[model samples]
Target: MSRFALFLALPLLFHVGCGAESGDEDVDPLAGIQIIGDDLSDIPLRGASAAQVARFKEGDRLFDFVFRERDGLGPLYIRASCAGCHEGAARGPGAVQKMVLVEADGVTPAADQAALPYGNTMRPYGVGGATTLVQPEDDLVLKLSQRLGPPVFGRGYMEAVDDAEIERVAAEQAARGDAIRGRINRVVFHSKKNADEAFHRFSEGDENLIGRFGFKARVATLDDFTADAYQGDMGITSPLRPSELPNPDGLTDDAKPGEDVDVETVNAVADYMRLLEIPKRAPADPRGEALFVEADCAACHVPSLRTRADYPIAQLADIDAPVYTDFLLHDLGPDLADGLIDESASSTSWRTAPLIGMRHSTSYLHDGRARTIEQAILLHDGPGSEAAGSVAAFRALPREEREALIDFVRSL
Candidate 1:
């Protein structure tokens, strides 16, 4: 049994081992302890309806519930539950290492993945007699990248942003003539959606939609994002993505036959993501805010984007979301490139990471290699990087000014 299975079974053992009278009551020793508000990363959005609150609670429970082999955890898997990688709805220690065959330059991806069949994702664990794992071969692999799971808070507002708004930002950047232009990541929709889902609808025969989620901006909506994580990370199939990923033994099914989870569960999880609120910002230094904009850091990391007027979530609709991302793809140049192509995005291209909860993070950047915010900023000065101009401006600042800017960003 997996650790999660053991955890879930502990409650049953307690119930069976002890028989307390219905009238018996035990007093808690620490019931009067006051709650501290330091960690509000998993709280729901302001002004949520009672019904919305109920759904958020249900989704919260499942997000932390761990699945075992009998629950279709994996013939192959990564972490066991949503919370495995995103503990407390924030960045956890879980990391997925992606490897692929690249060209001689060690930057561009190979023409095809035929040489390495298990695909880019390298699952670290296996179950149900499938012991072989996809480890990187030194001779075959040209490059490898480690991606840490991002926080899920305030995602509802990000998902609610209109495609037109994303396009508007892209167009403005293109017109600026500053090598900082960003483009949208158009991707195919693979998840089920309600007919009246509040999002831009694609015309008949058009499969491409603007993507805003994921490192390369590959996932278009919260529901599909939830479904993809369930299948890809946990190896649990759902109606939206019913097929199991390629495994070593060529196994087509797991311990649980057919789909492991139902549509209701998927929707519940997505709704929970939609209702999560971004952590409130601390007071910003006026000088630092001005310096941040002057240094062009705000070019790709736009301070705010307005959500659609008709967003399904009442609390999230028609508001300026301070996510600090334009949700467009930008090439950070060769030094930061992971050498793994993702759909339309090249190896060096990445979506501008949001800065809503930077104060709570110990690591920075897509791979979490930068231990400090200053180090992450210096990395933007890589050769041929789009943020070169911004980094240059930041370097030109006085020592005190630079420290001020860093403090403002950390307080975000």
Candidate 2:
């Protein structure tokens, strides 16, 4: 049966007399629905051993390797190392970068608005001894912007998730009607090889596909994203991305041939992330779980997805993914627009982030603008406006209930 149909078939009154029943009388509504202990337990990736751990350490060393002016660091890059942006607090693979704004000349627009000659993510540090000024023939001109962002953690399980499951979640949400539509955000896959010579274009056939990672759902795979970080963040080159950045400006020498970096390093980092377990749930989390569904947060943050058994990792093999998300991009309204549109997503659209391990996350929202969970809840609008309304009802509940809900999120 469809998930929405099953949800509708279940009695909402199950919570009323659930705990009062004797063993022989009514079935516990929370029985099968109870948060599974296995969900919070650490699950390692397949074939991971002490040797793998040693290799991962080697990958960490590679991650910290700094590029010199001769090695080609960045003509346009963000940070010097992945750890620089990804470290601190239970950091996730998805980290945000910050930069300052200077002056620029590009497409003319309204005030409080200007276009960067290249794109967002202004690099604060450039290769040593390079001139900071843009050449006269450059496409556009802009200065730096202020710093913004922090790193997040736990990404390997995210990549291990079967694409079918993400589609299933979206199907389940759509079946619930337009009141809670969750659309998947299609993203570019950097590692995908173009069959045709259309590598630069954005097309469904361009080897690019739906995005499962990033706040905006931009990247396709952990490997692809890590490789991008190697080049864009650290100014390193690999086989998949061989061209070296030019000296001084750190611009890529497009005219030159590319080189290959060690694949083992990239693989180890991906393995480390894939095996990283989700945070454990708190004792009070069950109450929070009940409140999460009752509050309609599950409308978008729908939980309990079954993963494909064929996944490489034995721990994630044929398991139920308790990660709370529909994996869909929805309009967040003008209040949160980044003025950038990717593939199928609009300027105001953002992927519904998985709420797993949300308890460890302090800053909320895509831009990390909301300081607390409550503020994040309040910032919802558009398709998620109903969820925001649900939060309001949740707040009206007894203080203990609110605490339970918070506790549940921490447990995940």
Candidate 3:
């Protein structure tokens, strides 16, 4: 059965227990029908072919698989599986530490870092006793940042958003002459990691690709994201990432190194990620909706977006999904800065985090520093961020209206 149909098949009487609802009380009509992460973030979107459904199920199995040294886990690595950092398929308790040497300006990453611990990521775990944790001796001198694994939901829709549309929004924001000057982070691409392998113009001919996923938009596609997580977070090399890096311990259980996992395994996992459903938006209060617009939070946290009709998924094509993001990189001020340059994204720049599944997240921001949504909202100020006025407007709201706004955001 389709995901939506399964939800409708449930008896309606099950919901109207007590004071939570009246006879017509409205929750997300499709609340409980999930392919993965029941009551959480990893549901599959509606309208999958039987074959697609099978792949999604298989992918989920692979995503949760734990690897050992026999499976070529690591000579040098961090965890053993994909699910380790992103347990429950939600924002990470699996924190990825990034170390970068800051130059004299204190914003750009140092050009030469041969003396530093490792490149960008630090993994502390390895196969048995074969791994030494990557801890820099100059921990104070190097700008260290913790990257929380973001929830993997509704990414297919985000992938379907046309590049022209993203550029168009950037132009519109530029035309507005406001503080929100959002830019794209362009990075490199390889064949195995490009989800649309034959499609990306750069992937076909050039190697330069536009960045879309991750806190700094360092990754471009779900396949790339999966491959990167496999190698960087788990120390497991797949066909997508054919080689392993030298760990701090310089240990290896595998005699020969080229391919640890087959390409089919990586592709299966990517397929599952490709279909993850966007959590349904909580019903909005009219007053909170108006305040959201009034506060100019809508300027950056755009409430709705349309996907092109040509997108692969039938249910997702040409749909007006409320994704609540412009997907461009913006500077959220100095407090949020980490000095880690991700491709074109500067140390101060971070992708405007989509608020689609905000209710499921207990921690907020790239580093998971903000515990409350309100604290996160207040952090959106500084020289380059355009949300300073919006922050002031939000702070001035009446207590009831403020709670209403918070409730509205949580509903997403």
Q: Which model scores highest in TM-score?
A: 1
Candidate 1 — worst ten consecutive residues by lDDT sum? 13-22
Question: Estimated TM-score per prediction?
Answer: 0.89, 0.71, 0.84
| Residue-level lDDT tens digits of model 1 in 97-144 | 677788888788879778777788877677867854555454674476
**Poorly placed runs, candidate 2 (over 4 Å):** 1-48, 64-71, 92-115, 131-152, 192-208, 244-250, 253-260, 382-386
**C-alpha lDDT of all candidate models, in order:** 0.78, 0.54, 0.69
Top-down TM-score ranking: 1, 3, 2
Candidate 2 displacement at residue 362 in angstroms: 3.1
Of candidates 2 and 1, the better by lDDT? 1
Give the count of colliding residue pairs in each prediction.
0, 26, 0
Residue 116 alpha-carbon offset, candidate 3, angstroms: 1.3
Candidate 3 lDDT over residue span 177-289, tens digit each: 65777888777765444444432334423444657888888777777778877877767777667667666655533533567777678778877777777776667676887
The number of the candidate with the highest lDDT is 1
Model 1: what TM-score? 0.89
In model 2, the Cα lDDT at residue 383 comes to: 42
